[model samples]
Target chain A: MTLYERLGGEPAFQAAVDDFYRRMLTDERVSRFFDNVDMDGQIAKQKAFLTYVTGGPAAYTGKDMRKAHEHLWSKGLGDEHVDVVIEHLGATLIDLGAKAEDVAEVAELAESVRKDVLGR
Target chain B: MNPDRTARPAEPSSAIHLKGRTIPLAAGESVLEGLERAGIEAPSGCRAGTCCKCMLQGEDPPAMSQRSLRPTLRAQGFFLACQAYPIGTLELSSGEAPEPIDTVIQSVEAVAPDVARILLRPEDSFAFRPGQYLDVLHPSGALRSYSIASLPSDQVLELHVRRIANGLVSSWIHEQNEGQRVQIRGPFGQCFHVADDEQKRLLLVGAGTGLAPLLGIARDALEQGHKGSIKLVHGGLQPDRLYMRPQLSELAETWPNLEVEHCVLREATEQEHEGPLDQVAIRLAGSLENTRAFLCGDAEIVRLLQRSLFLAGISSAEMFADPFSPASP
Candidate 1:
């Protein structure tokens, strides 16, 4: 089976994405970056991005990561913020019963975009 | 707009042209840092130039920091990007890098008492050069690199693994079952024959499983219609330890230009040479002029031969060595 199928596909990704945002929003260190953003649209874009990156069958039509996060630099997004998001994402994946290897894989994929997410 | 406005001097911006894109470099920044800043993902390991993973061809002469590169590679303008700083506008080329692939073991057998010859069938897209090495990710989460012993035409990857006592990865590899999936990451290193000329003589020396890559190199040279003589010396502590003697003898019979010799340290036989393999090879080879030499196996032997060959008038450009190291804990 494809990694997407093994990951439980759309339903699994949605639950993990929801939990990721929940944890991120409550974390004081990274919450300020999303203070003035539209949460619903942000969540939808993030979900599509994660789905596509994690081998799921979804097309992410939103702006590429660098462009999407360029405006966040002025809002104090940095390496620490990216680290927090990755930590939350990893935690959410584990909480959703993903295999440890799969969780590590997803975390590595997210970390690969550190420069883009920090607008470096 | 005032027509009399004096044009400001062009800002000094050093840059590198790589992959058809211009990446500006900051003062005191290495080429690798500039490429990373431009979002170009260059393959890197150890990032200090020791691993040679970030090697790239450039238009400029190699930087002083690139003195560790092979003389041939440096002469060809290949430099480690991690250590090189842009002098001016430079054009760098990094051809399509090979990606890691999943492979399944086809078979594994002990060709020698201590040596296991493993055959693997990689996914259809996986490809590698003959003398390159690959990193095997073991089920125990340890990674160990092994050289490829098979020719490209074989359609399967072959590895000669010397069983290391108490080694995590090597022991696991010896215990692995047929059809087990393995994650392989590379085809790395630059030790293959380039066939620069048809009459270029080759001297290959190997010890233990180091013979694996040398064997691949010899077969590749012969297959490519190399017209010059190919001499191979396999060294071991005992006569019975010269594992591939029969196969090599068969190969010698088929390829008239190829000569195979086995050298043992403590035993003497009319068919084999006595003493150290490197010493025996030097005696047999006579002069080192104009011959390409490849040395592999024990680190001490490789070092001794490397120094000996260099002093005997062999250019550093014509010598290639792969010093063997045991798998890390």
Candidate 2:
């Protein structure tokens, strides 16, 4: 089974997304990117990101990620912000009861798009 | 764009009808591509469902097109035009800006020091959900958005206009007299009440004139025979900022399932609860499970309430928010 199914699939994601978003919003290191953004749209994108990282069925592509984050690149989106996101992703998965190894797997998956996210 | 309408069966052949124009779709062509082929300007990005910029309301849209949207939007027949591949004739709606409707001011009364309760009678058939907002056009081309406070049964549009200091559209609206005609466009916004589950608890929280939309949703839910416990929390900077107390109290008294609470930041009266608005709302709400929350008012405060409520256990899907961007003076 994929890590998504192992981690409880779609039913488990609603609360996970909420928890993950709260962490991101409260984290001072990365909160600036989120200010004044459309809440619903951001939430939807975050959910899609979660699904992508967790190996759930999503239509996320590298081209899409690069295009999505292009506007934020000028606002100082870089490796540090990507690292913070990875940290939060790991923490959110750990909080949701994923095994350490499973989290590493998700992190590796999330890391694959780092170049695209930074628009490199 | 009412989702409550009975859905029609999809036709065997595929075509898209938009704004009085019908464009036949090539086999396997997406709705966005078809619209573009017909020289129509439909907003789109990513050419995929991820961006959600190409959302359109339709009759029985393909299920795949709505998979990424929120439940409320999905219920409202909203789908991404980029991802839709309708097998039958699809009628897209509200793509173009609606023409302004001429309405006569029926009455205007001051509900608070800076707020006016303006009632208007539209000369045209304006079909809109209660909590949606419409743009009131000023004579000089300036316009402002106000939430509808009255239900369809009232046969008139009720708007609560908070007069911003030196605000162009607001100042003009406050000075208008009865019998004066005004132009209005759109009944837009998705923050209205939906009777998905009758037993689900409802929380309506707003600050300042944000109370307008919450009041509309509360009454709409009650009118729809919702059996759920409904809580309406209205907050302000001080006691005087809270308006329409007697009407709210009368509503709560008439409906046993309804509860009304007034909150203020400072100078609380004996009848009012004094504290931070978000804290007060979460405290009074008690349990958050199976609860649907509607939050409105200042953009910053709405964001705070949305985050707090989501962390406190309400699902993101169940929370509907209408954050008003501050008007530049």
Q: Give each prediction's DockQ, rounded to 2 decimals.
A: 0.01, 0.33
lDDT scores of the candidates, listed in order: 0.76, 0.89
Off by over 4 Å in 1: A1-120, B1-99
What's the lDDT for residue B153 in model 2? 93
Worst 10 residues of 1 chain B by lDDT: B3-12
Instruction: Give the lowest summed-lDDT range of ten residues in model 1 chain A.
Output: A54-63
Look at candidate 1 and tell me the lDDT of residue A79: 84
**In order, what are the TM-scores of chain A for the candidates?**
0.85, 0.96
Across A2-111, the per-residue lDDT of candidate 2 in tens digits comes to: 88778877658766888888889889999888887777777777877897888776667899889878999999998999999999999998988899999999999899
Q: iRMS values in order, in angstroms?
A: 26.7, 4.3
* Candidate 2 C-alpha error for residue B290, in Å: 0.7
Taking the tens digit of each residue's C-alpha lDDT, what string does model 1 give over B1-329?
A: 76456565454467898667777788988888888888888876546444456778888744664665555466457888888876777788656655668899999888888888899888756666677788888766688888888987898899998888887787778888899988888877766777777797899988888888898989988999999999998888887777867788999999999999888898778878999776788888876767999888867777667656644555545778777776556
Most accurate candidate by TM-score = 2
